[model samples]
Structure formats: C-alpha cells, structure tokens
Target: MRRREHESLTAGPVCPSTRSPRYTCRKLECVFSLGHPSIARLLTIKLGSGHAACIRFNRSGDLLASGRLDGTIVIFDIETNGVARKLRGHTRQDWKCVLWDLQDGSRLRTIRFTAPVFIAELHPNTHLKFVAALFDDQPILVDATEELVVKRNFQSAPKRSQLDMDEATEKILAQDAKQTTTVTTFSPSGDYIIAGTNKGWLNIIETASCQTMFSTHMAGGVITLLRFAPGGRQIVVNSSDRIIRTVHFPDLTGKNVDFGNFRLENDHKYQDIVNRLLWNHVAFSATAEYLVASIHMNHHVYVWETAHNSLNTILEGPTEELSAVEWHPYKPFLAAVGIDSGEVHLWSVIAPQKWSALAPDFAEVEENEEYIEREDEFDVVASEELTKRILRQEDEDIDVLTIDPVKGYGDHQEGGFKMPVLLHQDDEDSEDEIEAIGAGQYRRKSPGRGRDRNTANEATHQNGRR
Candidate 1:
C-alpha cells in the first residue's frame, strides 16, 4: 500500500493594488474592471499546493468544496475562513467528487475510480449524492451517505486460465483498448445523469433504474462539458471542435426509439486558437438565461444569451489563461472566475452607478420650468383631441370603372349618337369632346328624341351600375 501526503492552506486577507486598471482589490474584496462596469470579489482563499481544478459551493453557501490535481479535496468553511477537513486519495489523479457535511464538515466522502475522473456534478435536489464520469469507462453514481457506488455501468471481463493466453498478449490487448468519459452532469430534477465521452457521444441515464435513456453522437471532436440549464429543460454542450451548442430534452416518458432523441436548438462557433489548456469550461446563469464559456488559450470569456443565440457580453480575464468558472447558485448577480494564477476572482454583474458632474437638479424651479410647461401643454392637447383622432376614419371611396370606347357613346338617334355625360367639368369643356361630338357638353336634338332618348339613357345607366 502507498501512503499519501496531504497539505492544507488557510485563507488570509490580501489587498491588491488599487491603481491597477485591470483589477481593483481591497480587504477581502477584489473588483475586476471590465470595460463597462466593475465586478467585486467577495472572498479569496489561496490553496498552497496543487493547481485547483474544480470548485463548488454548497446550497447554503457556508461550505465550499475545492478539488485539485493531486487528488486532494479540501472543504472550506466560508464563515470562518478556514479549512474544515482535508481528505487525500487517488494520488496524482484529479479528485472528481467531494461530498462534505454542510453543518460542520465532520463527515467527508471522496470517490476515486480506477481511471482519472474528468467531471463530477452534485445532484440539485440532494447533497449526499453525485454523478461522475470516469476515464475510459461509463459514468457512476456515488452515494455519499453509504460511501458506495449505488449505480454504475461497469462490465466484468471474462476470467481466463494462465494457459489460455500469455501475459505479454494480455498486456498488448489492454494497451490497445482505450475509452474515456470526458464530462458528466446531473439533471436538475436529479432523476437523470448526463455524461459525455471522448468520442463525441452523450448519454442520458435514468438514476433509479441505472439504464441508459438515450445515447447518441454529438460532434466530431471530444465533448468537453455537459451542463443542464436551471430549468433542466435544456442542456449546453461544449466540445473540442470549438462549437458550443444547446440541446433540448422534451418529455421522454414513453418514447421507445434510442437514436436522435435529443434535439439541438442553437449553436455558436468559437475562434480557433492553438493552446494545450482545456478550454471546455461552460456555465449557465442562475436563471438559465445566459451562458458563459472560456475561450481556448485566450484571456477572455464569452457570455451568450440563450434566447437570442447571440453573444451578449465578453468578460475579460486576467493576463493568464482562465481555467474554470462557476456562477453563484442563489446570487444571480455574482460569478466566480478561476484563472491559472491560483486566484479565484468574484465578479458581480450588477454595478454601482457613479454620479456624473452634469447631473440634473430636480429641486430647482427654474431648472424644471420648461419641462413642466411642456407637460401641461401635452396634457391639454391629449385630453382635447386624443379621442377624436383615434375615432376619425381616413378611408376614401375609390371608383373602379371599365369603359369600352365603342359603348361610351349612348344609343344611336336619328341625327347622330347622343354623347355620354362627362363627370368632370374640365372634360366637358375640353376641345376634344366638342370636336368628337360636334357639340359642347350637349347632345344633338333630332325629330323622335324625347321618349327614345330618355329610355336609352336609363338603360345605359343601369348597365353601368351592373
């Protein structure tokens, strides 16, 4: 058996330089100056030994769980600014999940797998359980109370005698077989566990039955992160192919088909950059309205709006590369960003308004006299004409007529055809009408014109009406 060496670091108050334009720090408070407004860092706890890989705050915000690369899990009491318990296991591999006693951090449970664990997520409804993705293996659900694997997808290999195969052949076969689980997360309802593999496949398993509900390939590259939105109706995925996408999960109660069950709603492509650091970190806001992701090897974070499928904001990080980011569960306005410099920054979306020198004086009579007069004039006009203007009709009657040149002239009389009456006075007075009819705005009289002309005019008017 190998013994493990453990080390723990305590929190201390450190004030950063106020003159620096990028970061502003005071006692227990650090404000990051993004272009528009500043975000304040509420608390900072420095871990002395290994690089911090992941951090999670309990529901009460009194306890914080931080995991490191050296397989050391430390539980910090935020109220006291001290370490409550430090557990050591799975040397050299990253600590995937750490469950601590929120009341006093007395009871601690750490889960270690045969291969390194890439992702771990606590159940939203319960604190004593979590789901973890193991390297080259299926995901496992850990029971914190019993400290046992309640559910897992492990398959036992067939046993063989020594004569069946040589040791060298078995070693070569084992080396050739490679599988990896890159990321895993629990759904908001705690009924399903979502896991992603290196082959760009995602699997959703039922927690009660431990059966796979849906599994399908998502992208070409490895999947980096799988996060369920606050409502659990949708999930956001980040992959090594530089694509961030959102998938929706509808009611999957009676659906029998396996493949193509998940539907993609939106996606965003990130800029290409050459760096070895893992840029797959993604998080959703408390309200699930906005999503934040770290850029690969870049000192910037992208904030996206799920509704618009557009970039909403860019949060600037430190000069060093960003490692991870977590949003406050209860505080929708606060966010914690972790950088490579071993510093965890606290940022707030809400900023204080700074008073300007040209602010208006609301108390002075002269300053508001013009506004008051305009308001009075607007009120008088609105009351007097608003109703009338709303009720007034602007429609005009349009007359559509199809006239035939031959039938435009009335029925023929004994002398000549009776000319049609012009609706407009200008047309009646025109020289063209006089030359065509040999009369100005009048019909020529003939011997039998009285009754015949009247009957013919009445028939023509009736035909025009039809």
Candidate 2:
C-alpha cells in the first residue's frame, strides 16, 4: 500500500441544532440527515421489526443487503429504493450457517458445526469454501464442494494438563480460554485466511490447504472484527482492547510466497485516548486511505488517515447510536444504521450540480423562489431585412451535420443498400425502374411513386408563388 501523507480535515462540523434543513447554501458541505442531513438521500431501507445488525453492498453497489436482528435478511435495490428480497433463516436450526440463493430466496446448503460459530464467511471467489471461527475452538476451513470435509487452520494448543502445574488453577484456566479463535476472515484476494482469538493472537492461514503461515499476538483483549483494505497488503483489526490496528503484510502478489519468513512487520494502532471510546464497528474507506469507526454510544464516527495514523475528520450526525457502517464500493458515500429507529442513515456530499454554477447571481435555496414575468417578456415586433441571407444566398441549404449514413447492423448486401419492391404482373402500365442513390446502392422504384416528397413540395410551392 502506498503511504498517504499526513493530512487533517479538522473542519468543525455543523452542530445538529443550528444546522438548517436541506444542507444548502454552504460551500464546504457538512453531513446531513435523511428524512431526519444528507444533501441527496438515495435510499432508506427500514427493517420490519428489529434493528439492522449488518449491511453489505453488492459488487456493482446498486443493491444493499442488510441483516436484521430479527433473523431476517433484506436485499434492497437502490435504484428503485425498494426491498428486492427478504430472506430468513435459523428459526429452529442452530449452530449452523445456511446459505441461500438470493434469486428465489431458497436455501441452497447448510454447514453445521459442533461448536457455536462466531462468524463464518464464504470465499469471495467461490462459495464452496468456508472459513469459520468457533467459540471454544480454533478457526477451521471447510470444503463444502461435495462432502463435509474440515481442516483445522492453526496448530492445536497443547492442553494445560500436559504442561507442568506450577501456576495457579485460575490463572491457568484464563490462559487456556484465550486459545480459541473469536473472529476470522478471508483476506481480500482469498489466498490468505486470518483468524483473531480471544487471547488477541492473529493467525494467518493458507486458503488452499489450511496451513498456518504467520501467527502473532496483537492485543490482550478479544479480537472482534478483521477487515482488509481494498489492497490485499494492508489490513485493519478491531479488538476488544479499544484500539484499532492496521497491519501491513510484506507480500503484494496473491501467488504462492515463502510463509516461513512471514511476519507482522508493520502495523499502526489507533484509539480514542481522550474519551476512551469503545469502537462499535470499523471499516476502511473506498480507497482504504482512511479508517472509520463508530463510537459505543456517540452519534459521531471517527475517521483516521492511514498514512500518518492521525485523526482526519469526525463525521457528526444521527442522534441515535450508529452501528454497522458500510462504505460504497466506488463512491464517496456511506451508510450507517441507527440503533434506536432502525433507519439506514446515508451520508454523502454529492450535491446537485446545475447550470446555476455559471450564473453569477446563483444561490442555493431550500425552497423554489417565486418567479414573476414582465408584461413584454414574449411580445415581439420585427421588420428588418435579413443581412446574413443576402450575404450568403446558398447558406440556407448547407447542413453542418452532413455525414454519410452508417451501415445498419441487421442486414446489408456487399458494400451497398438494396431495397426491394413488389409489383403485380397483371398491371400493364408497370415499368421496371431502379434508383441508384450511391455507389453499388440500388432502390427498386415503386410504379405509382413518380415524384419524391421534396419534388412534390417544390411543385406545390411554385403554384403557391404563381
């Protein structure tokens, strides 16, 4: 990843109270609420009963899939601003992740585990592979292509009974508890799998055969979330330690590399030291140059520049607590769900650009200004000789857009246009005629069509003049 320069967007946000509606009349735009600060609110998909737990954007970004706390998943179409599909699973079933076909909202397959799964994600390239983290066991990779084949990604930790019992029992139990993986995710390229344990250890595993490539202890608290930058090299880890760490891997190519020398060589840590805010969720920007995390109970979202690891800007909006923030894949847009209202709050600065920018007296307005026309606005009186017409008498027939017609795609003979006409053989006055408009182009003339439309119009104009 290219290192971005230390930059600060320290512009103080417009407070929610003093800010006007519509967010207009401002040069440097600020965050606005939708139905509740957004300049252009695209969509607001509300869940039926419970709050949204997680949200993800489709590859093209025209659709949003949000999982609600009520065990229902809703796929929304942004263009229509309507719900496209609602999927529900795990009503009676437990300890399993059921994959569903979105097109018909039908269950495709289900992968069950002995232990409670904290999170299970399918490989980006193929749905047949799964990387799952268990509550009291190490993370494992499963090949669901045919049968239920599982492979433990990390080496099994030696049981405490096998070690010398010099330490206290409570201390030993605590140490053993940290051995299980709490969160796991596949790297951006799907070649490397990463798992975060309750003990704060980060393990990198090979996706092909589930081998441990690199392992390191990152924090003392449990690692809850792991997100990779758009680039495969850098990754951001969210843990219970109240700090977000962005780690940089040595390899750039997704091909096979020497894992024996793999290491967590470079990583940056970010935290709210002043307020000691607990981050709810963390995500990267579209370009992965900045990191954004929501506060526990705060309405603002903190953004930090990955280059200098300094605070860039604080997104201030949404009175209720914000959770599960998702950045649009290819835009400066962001969507955050409110904990209290279940409303998906959208934040974007894409204001309406119009020809008003060229007008010197243009101004932004909340409501349309009333227009009063003058009495002589449409009145006209003209009795002047045409100077241009006399200057260029032949200019009237000149077509500036004079260009050859393009060949039609459906049907055309070799290098020419040929149109056929049907005639009855009983007609005695029928005469064989053909009109050649261009080189190798012919039109079978109609018997009754003696004159073209322009020629007939010219004859009528002469009679009118006479």
Candidate 3:
C-alpha cells in the first residue's frame, strides 16, 4: 500500500498567484525528466504594485492570489486575465491575535495575550479552535466559541497548552526550560498538529486533545517550516540546520501509533553540507512526487523526486536570489518570486505539437531511414464520397485520454470529477493514490459555503496556508 485512507473536503479552503506567460529567457533547466516533464519554458507575472511574499492557485489552475509585501493580496483571474480583488488590512503591534474576515476585510475576533505571539494556525477541521506559538511559552489550543457575543475571547490559549500544567508549575518550568515553539502547522487532514522548536525538537500533537503524540530530535538549529504533502503521508521539514528532510510515514494511523520509529530511506535527507545553504521555502508538486525549494540568497531552485529521495532537477533563473517557490496545483509547472525584481517567474514543460497521426502519408522518425514508398500512396486523382456516411452519429462520443501518467488509476478519476471543486471529498484511497489529495489543494471561488464554513476558512487562513 502506498498511502492511508482519510477524510476529504469538497474544495478545501486554499489560500492564491498568476496570469499569461511572457517569455523571459531561452535558457532551460532539465534533468532525467523525472516522473513529470522538466520545465521547458519560463513565464513571468508582474504586479505593478508591491513585491509578492506568497502565492496560490485555484483548483482549475485558472486563477491566482499573490500576497505582497505592502500587505495587499491581489487575486488574479487567469481565465479573464484580470484582478479579481485585493484583500488588505491595518497593521498592529505585538501581544494579540486578531482574526480578520477576508470577504469584507473586517476583524472577526481578537485574543489578547500577556506575551507576544510568534505564530498561530487554525485547526484544519474547525474555526472556533486554533493553535498559537507564544513568544514566551509553549503553544496552546484555543477555543473561541465565545465569539457569538461579538467580543474578543478574553481567555487566551495560554492555559490550553501542550504544557498543560498548573499556573505555578507552568511559570517555573517556563523559566527553567525556556523551550519555545518556532514553527507550528496542521496536517492536511487537520487531525494532527506538527510543531518544531528552536532546540531542533520535532513533535506531533493531537488537535483533538492538544496532546503530544510523538517527539524526536531531528535538527541542531531552529525549525522554520513543516509542510505535509497533499497526500498526508509525507512531510518536508526546513530548519536552520540546512537540511531538508522529506519524512515518510509508512503507517498513517494517527492514533496511538509510534511515529518516532518510522523509517526514512537512506537518501531521504537533502543538504548542502559544503555551502550549508538554508532553504528559504519548500513546496511539493501537486502530485507530491516532486519537491521544490528556493535556496536562501541563491539564484537556483532545487527539485527532488520522492520515490528515491534523489535530486531530480535544478531550475536556474533570476540573477538575484529567489525567495518563495510554488508548484502549479495540477500541472508540472513552477512559480517563484525574484527577491530583487519582485517579479514572478513561472516554468512549465512545453511539448512540441505533433500531427503525424492525422496524416497516413506522413511518418516521423528521429534518424534517417531509406524510404519505401507504395505506388498507391501518391495516386489520389479521384474525389470520392464516403462509402456509407451520415451528417453525424449521435451514439459516438470522443473519449479523451486524460489520465496523467504521473497519477495512478484511483487518483485520476477524470470522469468522476465534479465541477468547480478544488479538493475531492472522498475517504477511499488506492495504493498509488495514498499520497494524492483529490482534486489537488484548491478551494471553490465562492468559499463561503455558510457562516460556519466561512469562519473556518478565515480562521485557518491566518495560520500557515499551504
């Protein structure tokens, strides 16, 4: 078996980036064509305003959202090639967590804390609950069900923390241990919480109970990002230690299971020991078969295939260092932001069009071969009608070969697909599809399914969105 079966959402709320491709350069980077075609061309998306800090694509791969350094997020409509909307908000200082509504750019609720917060993430399954990394103490699970009264939840998540100890002991340990969570995130399924600390400790906590399930030491420096593959069986971790570890979970039963004992292939770890380069940001291909990361202060983007944990390709571009990098949700395409120019660079395979199948007389061969021409091949003097023809055949339909060779049978159900869905909501999984997140990581355009759904979307979005 390749993956574990898990619940899915119809168009899981996703965060946006893109428009048309403008040829920037002729230089192409490719190697082995591993699993997916190597990116053959470059496309550029330039926003007149601020530099892009992050980006995302809708399910159809026809829309994008680019969050800029100026605190404005511009949603680009790829179909019509226009800007859909721009989301922005007022800035504030430390010591509080505020939830803002993106639909109207309004604040939903705020949770004030005594100590400043480093980062926070909403539970994948709900909005009333969230996890926050404190600048002073351990992370906590907050329940904000008190928002109905239209006031902030006075009780911050400090009490509901992984260090679920009494007030006195918590304070004493906080002074002695001084352990702080540097990075926090949720699993794709939203059932488990993965967090890392400056001490290089990797941990998995249950979202339901806010309890630690597994803990292990994996790095020597502070951990920065923890991205679960869309499939949920794998996780890629970035740290100051300069190692990119692609973690694989053979048994994905997230209950009472010992994850510390999970095995990683010999080649699963990636690092530039000589340069000790830190990976700025890392992303998994839509199929999670490939991993791409932008190196800190470097002009190259590195891609690795997971099957063997080997370096698949190194995409070279941008004279300045590249910052954020993302893979097209459903295509073998990649987009990265230039640290200096603030322009978005896109890459995708552009295969040559072939029409030999339509013409019987034409044959395409790589190398020269002696021609054996038949006499009847060139004799076409008579104009004839079809032997037995009709205006059209109602019973016949075109069957498109839409199966992605990179995807397995159960995962690529082109015929079973529903319209306007970014994620496929299913619990059954196939062996090869164990890592596939149905419909890719996208959300419906009208994400406000209801008040509850909207709340969940808005809340979780504040956390690290993939």
Candidate 4:
C-alpha cells in the first residue's frame, strides 16, 4: 500500500440534521436535508422483511441478489425493476448463506451448515465456484455449477481435553459432532482457498490439490475474517480476541520461506471468547496498495496503506453501523452498507479530474449564479454567511476530501470495468474521469517509448550476432 496523507475534506455540503428530511432545490442547485445525507443515490427495495443479511450484484449490474434471514435469496432486475427470481432452496433448511454468480444467472447456490454462516463470497473470475464459512461445520467450497456438489470441505475441530469429556459429552460426540470454520476467501489470483476456524487455526488449500499448503495456530478462539492482500503476498486474519494479524506464507511448493507473523493493534482484549463475530469483512484497493478494515465495537473503518503499514483515513458516520464494505473493481470509491437502515454509503478517497459527477446540480447552480450576477451587474458577492450558518451548521465529525492522482483501472472487456483494485474505496469524480486507488504522480508514458528492435534489425542482428 502506498502512503496517503491524511487531510481534512471541507468541500462537501454539510450534512443535514438527523431530525429533518433531505430536500434538493433544483433551481438553486443545492441540496439540504432534514439531516445531512451522506449518500448520493439510494434505492430501497422492500425485502420480504426489513432485515437483509447480504447483497451481491452481477457483473453487468443488471441483477441484484440479496440474502435475508428468512433463508430466501431475492434477485431483482435493476433495468426492469422487478423480481427476477426468488430461490427457496434454503428457505426450509438450515442453510447459512446463498450466492449468485455474476457471470451467469442460470444457477444459484446455497450453503447448508450445522451452524450459521458468518459470511460467504464468490470468486471474481469464476461462476461455478463459491465458499462459505460455517460456525459449526467446516468451511465448504461448493461447485454450484455441478448440481451444488461439494468440491472440498475444510473442517477444524476444537481441541478438547480427555478429562473434560463426560457421559453427556460422549453421547454428544457419538452423534457426530460438527466442526466450525469461521472465515473463508479466495486468493486474489484465484489459485488458493483460505479458511479459519475457532481453534486459531488458519489453513490455505491449493484449489487443485485440495491439500493444505499452510495451516498454523493463533492464540485461540475462532478467526473472524481472512483477507488476501492485493499483491497476494500476505494474508490477514482477525479473531474473536481483539487482534488483526498479518501472516506471510512462503511458496506453497515446500520452499524455504514458509513463515508467519501477527500483530495486535486493538486496545481492549477479551478473555475466553466463545462466539465468533458476525460482521467481518476485508477489502484491498485497486493497486493492491492498501487494505481497509472495520474496527470491531468502535464502528470505525481504518484504511491501512500497504507500503509502510500506515493508517490512511479513518471514516465514521452517525447512527448506522457499517455491516459490509467493498472497494470498486475499477475505481477509487468505497461502498459500505449500513446494517441498521439498509443504506449504502459511497466514499471517494481520490478526487476525479471533473468533480461535477458527484452532485449533478453543481454545474447548473454555478450557471445560475453567473446569470444572476450578469443581470444585477453589481460588484457585491452574496454574503449569505450568517443566514447559511444558521440554516446549516458545520459537521464537526466530517471533513472535505482531497484526491490524489492515480492510474485508474482499465475498463472491462465484456462491457463493464473492474477497478484494478478488487476492493474499491475511491469514488469517480465524473463519468469520464476514472478514480484510481493508489495511483501517484508518475509521468504518463508516450506511445513510442518502446521500439521493435527485432523488426528494425532482423537481418543486421542475425548476421552480426550469429
């Protein structure tokens, strides 16, 4: 991760008070709410219930899939604004998670576990494969394309003492005790499947071999989340104990560099924790230069630059606690979902070349101000400072943003674009200007920087060198 300078953002409109409704004045080209609204656009679809567990979007952004507590997966078509399909596979069963492939819509997969699923995810490049963490059973990697068959299962058993085994424990054991795997994710390259369990055990299985390449211990308790770095060089795991550890693995082919390291940055520590955390998510930027993670309990998200392990920006909001976070696939925007209100917040860490894309009315408002000045032909600037200050108070918790120039991710060949960073936190300033996560002030290269030496000296080099 590249180092980012922490600066205050004062350019944004002051957030409205929470007591009032947000209203936009089209003529004035300004927006004011009963309270300050941080979201630019929000579309709320009535779920069967108000509760939503997870949300996923297809590659084309045409379909939106959400899993609810009712064990049903809801699919909606954004273009038609209608229900595409309602999957009932997990409705009656004890399944913990459901995932829809962005590449194809013909298939939907669900994970059945003895325990509830904390979180699940699909590979960015594949459709048939998906992984889910089971609180009671092993994290199962299911091939949803093949009739939802289980391709590989990773079970982590908790260590038990012989003296602690009673008759009831033996009876429970005889009935087939279930194991628990708390977190799982695919490597950035999609070559490895990583999972963590309650025993502080971390396992990385090669997708092809289905064998453990790296399995190690933490102090104890379940690992809440596993995140692969953008460069795929380091794996960070969080546990029920207040600790976020970075583990480094050698080449999986039994090389000389197989080792691991961990660091605990949280202040408060719990003793003998039983239940794993529910909200655990990790995201990397487009350039794989930074990792953004939510600090448990505090309800604050910390941005960690990968270059020197420095904290970039600390993002906080009022009322709604963050449930999920995702970095833009091709841009520098970070999308965070609120758990309390089913609201999604988008934050742009970098500034786009054209800033008009953020608030559509900024340009129109500017134009109207210019026209009014021309009509009046007065040298006076509207000093509505006191009135404006009385109407909209400054937000002490929020700041204006400063964008650093970075190389934006390339567009997707299939139509859409993946922010070169899988985890997108940067926002695009405008449609034309793309936001890059960690792009710096490196000079742009010209087209003719590299010459075709072989084509120019085919005969001359062949005769001389041969």
- Candidate number achieving the greatest lDDT relative to the actual structure: 2
lDDT of 2 by residue, 1-466 (tens): 2111110000011111111111100012244322222232333333332234567776546567765433455566655555555566644325666666554456656666676667777776676566777666667787656665555556423222224445548776667555777777887667777787777878777777676666677786888888878777788888778888888866635476766566675568888798877787888887787777887778787777788887777777667677667776655667766655446666665545875768976777989889787899866644344555566785567677744544542222233322112222122211125344553254567756857877899999999999
RMSD of 2: 22.3
Q: Between the candidate structures 2 and 3, which one is better when assessed by lDDT?
A: 2
- Give RMSD to native, each candidate: 37.1, 22.3, 14.9, 23.6
Report the alpha-carbon TM-score of model 3 versus the true structure.
0.61
**lDDT per residue, candidate 4, 98-212, as tens digits?**
4433333222544455555555666545655666665455666666556646657754543333444543466555432454566778876566777776667666666665666
Q: CA lDDT of 228 in candidate 1?
A: 72
Steric clash pairs (candidate 3): 16-56, 16-65, 17-56, 17-64, 17-65
Candidate 1 vs 4: which has more TM-score:
1
After superposing candidate 4, which stretches have Cα over 4 Å from the reference? 1-50, 56-66, 71-93, 96-115, 123-126, 144-152, 157-179, 189-191, 249-280, 349-409, 415-466
TM-score for candidate 4: 0.52
Q: Relative to the true structure, how large is the alpha-carbon lDDT of every model?
A: 0.52, 0.60, 0.57, 0.48
Considering lDDT, which of the candidate structures 1 and 3 is the better prediction for this target? 3
lDDT of 3 by residue, 1-466 (tens): 1111111111111111111111111113233254664555443343343334556664445456665433444555543444555444413233555554433434556666555555566556555556666654667667665764222211112222344454457565563366577668777667777778777777767766666666667677877777777777788888888888887745445466665464433238888877888887788898898899998768888888788777877887767667667776677666676655555666766655676768875777889999888889887554433322332454568668654533432343343322232233232211111121232232233333377877888889977565
- Could you tell me the TM-score of candidate 1? 0.55
Q: For residues 1-466, could you state the per-residue lDDT of candidate 1 as single tens digits? A: 1111111121111111101111111112445333333444454443332334456654434445565434455555544544555544435434344454433323266555555555566665566566666655656777655645465562112223345446548564463244456677766666776767666767667777676656566766778777777676778887877677787766444435343435444454443345534454778776787777776456666677777776666666455555466665544433333443444554554445545435754343435444445545645575558667755643544456743333422332123222222223121111112111321122234546477879999999999999
Assess candidate 1 and give its lDDT.
Answer: 0.52
Q: Would you estimate the TM-scores of all the predictions? A: 0.55, 0.63, 0.61, 0.52
* Residue pair clashes in candidate 1: 136-179, 136-180
> Which stretches in model 3 have alpha-carbon errors above 4 Å?
1-40, 43-45, 58-62, 78-81, 92-122, 127-130, 134-176, 250-267, 356-466
Q: What is the lDDT for 338 in model 1?
A: 43
| Model 1, backbone clash pairs (residues 3+ apart or across chains), number | 2
Task: List residue ranges in candidate 1 displaced over 4 A.
Answer: 1-51, 60-64, 74-98, 108-112, 126-128, 143-151, 154-179, 252-278, 332-339, 349-466
